[model samples]
Structure formats: structure tokens, C-alpha cells
Target: MLIALFQILDFLLRIVGWVIIGQVIISWLFAFNVLNASSSGVRGFAEALERITAPLYRPIRKILPDFGGIDFSPLVLLLLIQILRMLLGGLAVELTYSDA
Candidate 1:
């Protein structure tokens, strides 16, 4: 059903949001030298996170002007994700009500 599909999408969006948060934290840890990127496990985890987030961040990074070292792509991506979720949720509600 459309509702079930919407639920699945919402869950996925939440998971991706968490992944982005984790990626940001991990990057900070690495930068602060609290986490060693040279370690195999650490490197693997970092690489995986990069792989998951890179696709979403790439286009935003291209459009936004670089601010020296500060990357705003993640924030932009999160905003976009929230907007998509709101649009999908509204669509789901409208569909449900129209069926009544």
C-alpha cells in the first residue's frame, strides 16, 4: 500500500540522516587525532561512511561556494532530505484523506 511505502521511505531517510551525523562526528574525531585514520578498522569505517554520503554531498558541494575549510554540503543535504520527507508525508496524507 502507499502508506507502507511511505513508512519505508521515512525510515530510510531517518537512517541516512543518522549516517550523516555519524560521518561528521567521525571526521571531527579524525581531525582532532582522537581517531587514527591509519588503522585498518578506522580507515575501513571512514571509507564506508564516505561512500554512503558522497553521492548526496557531491552535487551540493559543486553548487555552493567553498568557504575555505568549512563544508556546508552536509547541512544542505540534510535540509533537502527534510524537505523531501515533508513533501512525501504531505502526499501520503492527501492520498489517505482523499480515499475517505
Candidate 2:
């Protein structure tokens, strides 16, 4: 049962990681003028991503120093997510061994 829980958490973390990646790509597109900022569709998509990721980035943003116009919150969040995933994986391994 605990293993199943860990699997679920891992899957959710993967989804969050993808969402962060999507936001980063979208921001790059906007920055490069590849995506139309005037378009409602593009604006809506960007807004949605911002809303979803804002909470996750808030704390990290506070802790990280500003680098001109650059944002490192997403990268920091991704790294933290990877670390959590590794911990979950290790715990799951221990559980599997103990069960046997």
C-alpha cells in the first residue's frame, strides 16, 4: 500500500515537472516573438501556466537572488522535485526489501 502511494506521488511530481517545462518553453517563445502576445489563445495559455506555477515558484523566488531579468525559480523547483523523486524512490526500495 505504501509503495502504491509512493508511485502515485512520483507520477504527480512528473506531471508538475512537465508543467514547469511547458511554462518555460512558452515564456521563451514569448520572449523571442515566436508566439503572438496579442492573441487571446496565447495569452490564455500563458495565464493558465502562470496561475498553476505561481504558488510553486513564490517561495523559491523569495530565496533566490535576482539576476537582472532572468528567472531561476523554475529551475530550482525542478531540481527540488528531482531530489524528492529520488528520496521517494529510495524509500520505495526500502519498503520493497522489508516486505520480502
Candidate 3:
């Protein structure tokens, strides 16, 4: 049961990590204005990215110290998601080994 739980968490963390990466790429395109704001595809991706990534960024953004006007929320969010993935993966491994 615990193993199953850990595996589930690991899977979810991986999915969230992928979404974050996608959001990061999409954000870069938007930042550079390479993707038109009026295009339906861009708009759809923008909305999905916002819906997925904003909650993770909100708290991190609040606590981040200013650095010459640059925002570090994305980096922080990435780090956190990666760390969660790692933790879940480790738990999954332990659970598997213990079950064996």
C-alpha cells in the first residue's frame, strides 16, 4: 500500500515537472513576444500554463528577494518540483526494495 502510494506520488510529480517545463518554455516565448497573444493556440497554452503553474509560483514569488528587477519565481518553482520528484522517487525505491 505504501509502495503504491509512493509510486503514485512519483508519477504525479513527474507530470507536474513536465508541465512546469512546458510552462517555462511557453513563458519564454511570451516574454520574447514570439507567440502572438491573439492566436488561439497561444492563448490556450497560456491559460493552461497559468492554471497549472500560478499556484506554485504565488508563494515562492512572495518570499523571493529582489535581484536587480529580475524575478526568480520560476527557478524556485522548478527546484521545488524537482526536489519533490526526487523525494517521491526515493520513497518509491525504498518501498520496492522493502517489499522485495
Candidate 4:
């Protein structure tokens, strides 16, 4: 049961990490004019990504000092997610081995 819980948590963190990466890539594409924001599909996808990531990013943004136009919130978030995954993974391994 504990192993399963850890797996689910790890999976979720990974998904959120990918979403953050996707958001960054999409933003760069939009900035470079490779993606047309005027198009309905592109606009909708951007909005969806924003909606999904904004909640997670907002608090980090608040704590981070402004760096002109550069955003470091995603990097902070990914680091945090990685730390949590590592802690949880270690705990899960310890639990599995201790049961033997």
C-alpha cells in the first residue's frame, strides 16, 4: 500500500514537471512567433496550460524577487518537485527492503 502511494505521488509529480516543461516550450514558441496566438487552437491550448500551471507557479512567483522579464518560478517548482520525489522514493525503497 505504501509503495503504491509513493508510486502515485511520483507519477503525479512527473506529470506536473512535464506540464511545466511544456508551458516553457510553448511560451518560447509563442514569443518567437512560431505559434500564432491569434489562432483559436493555439490560444485555447495556451490558456489551458496557463490554467493548469498558474496555481503552482503563483506562490513561487510571490516569493521570488522580480528579475525584469525573466521568470524563475518554473525552475524553482521543478527543483522542489524533484526533491519531494527523491525523498518519497527513498522512503519507499526503505519500506520495501525493511519488509524483507
Candidate 5:
């Protein structure tokens, strides 16, 4: 039962990490003019990514100092996700040993 719960949480963290990566890639494409944001489909996809990631970035943005136009919030959030995953893994190990 505990392992199942840990697996679910790990899956969720992995999904969030992928979403962050996707948003970063999309932003890069837009910046380089590789993607046409003028098209409805592209615009909608970018907007959807933004909507999903904005909330995650908000608090991090508050704590991080601005670097002119460069945003590090996504990087910070990714690090946070990694840290949480590590903690979860440690807890799982500890719990499993306790049960044994």
C-alpha cells in the first residue's frame, strides 16, 4: 500500500517535470522565431502550457531576483521537484525497512 502511494506521487512529480521541460522548449522555439505564435493552434498550445506552469512559477518568481529578461523560475521549480522526489525516495526506503 505504501509503495503504491509512493509510486503515484513519483509519477506526478515526473509529469510536472516533463511539463516544465515542454514549456521551456516551447518558449525557446518562440524566441527563435521557429514557432509562429500567430497561428491559432500554436497560440493555444503555448497558452495552455503557460496556464499550467504559471502558478508553479509564481512563488518562485517572488523569491528570485530578476535577471533583466531571463527567467530562472522554471529551473528553480525543476530543482525543487528533484529535491522532493529524493525525499520521497528516502522515505520509501525507510518505511520499507521499518516494515521488514
Candidate 6:
């Protein structure tokens, strides 16, 4: 049914939101040196996160100016992910109501 399809789409949006958030947190810690490069677990997760987040971040990352030691792509990427979550969630809600 339409409601069930909406649920699936909503779940996917939520997953994307969570991945974006996790990427932000992981990138933040790594950028700040809180996690050492030699920390294999963190490194692995970062690598995985990179694969998911890179396509989103790459274009913006290219245009950003280097602020000494700070990286801001993750913040921008977080904002974009939030926007996507809200927009997709709204569509999902509309679909549920449209079925009525």
C-alpha cells in the first residue's frame, strides 16, 4: 500500500541522516586529532564513512578554502543532509495522507 511504501522511504531517509551525522562526528574527531591515525577501528570506520559521504562532500570540498587546520566540509554536508531528510520526510508524509 501507499502507506507501507512511504514507511520504506522514510526509513531510507532516516538511514541517510544517521550516516551523514556519523560521518560528521567521525570526521570532526579525526580532523581534530582526537583519534590517532594508527587507531585501526576509527580508521576503518572513517574509510567506510568516506565512501558514503565523499560524493556529497567532494564538490564543496574542492571550493572551500583551507583554514589552517580546520575542515568545514562536514559541517556543510551535515546541513545538506538535514535538508534532504526534511524534504524527503515531508514527501513521505504526504504520500501517507494521499492514500486516504
* Model 3 C-alpha lDDT versus the unseen true structure: 0.83
The digit string of per-residue lDDT tens for model 2 on 1-100 reads 8989999999999999999999999999999999999999899999999999999999999999999999999999999999999999999999899989
TM-scores, each model vs. reference: 0.96, 0.97, 0.80, 0.95, 0.98, 0.66
Kindly list the per-residue Cα lDDT of model 4 for residues 32-67, writing each as its tens digit. Answer: 999998999989999899999999999999999999
Pitting candidate 1 against candidate 3, the one with the higher lDDT is 1
Per-candidate Cα lDDT values, in order, are: 0.94, 0.98, 0.83, 0.96, 0.97, 0.79
| TM-score of model 1 (CA atoms) | 0.96
lDDT for model 2, on a 0 to 1 scale? 0.98
Model 6 error, position 64 (Å): 7.6
TM-score of 2: 0.97
Q: Count the backbone clashes (under 3 Å) in each candidate.
A: 0, 0, 0, 0, 0, 0
Q: Model 2, 36: alpha-carbon shift in Å?
A: 0.3
Error of 4 at 80 (Å): 0.6
What's the candidate order when arranged by decreasing lDDT? 2, 5, 4, 1, 3, 6
Per-residue error for 13 in candidate 3, Å, reads: 0.6
Candidate 6 pairs with clashing backbones: none
TM-score of 3: 0.80
lDDT accuracy of residue 77 in candidate 5: 98
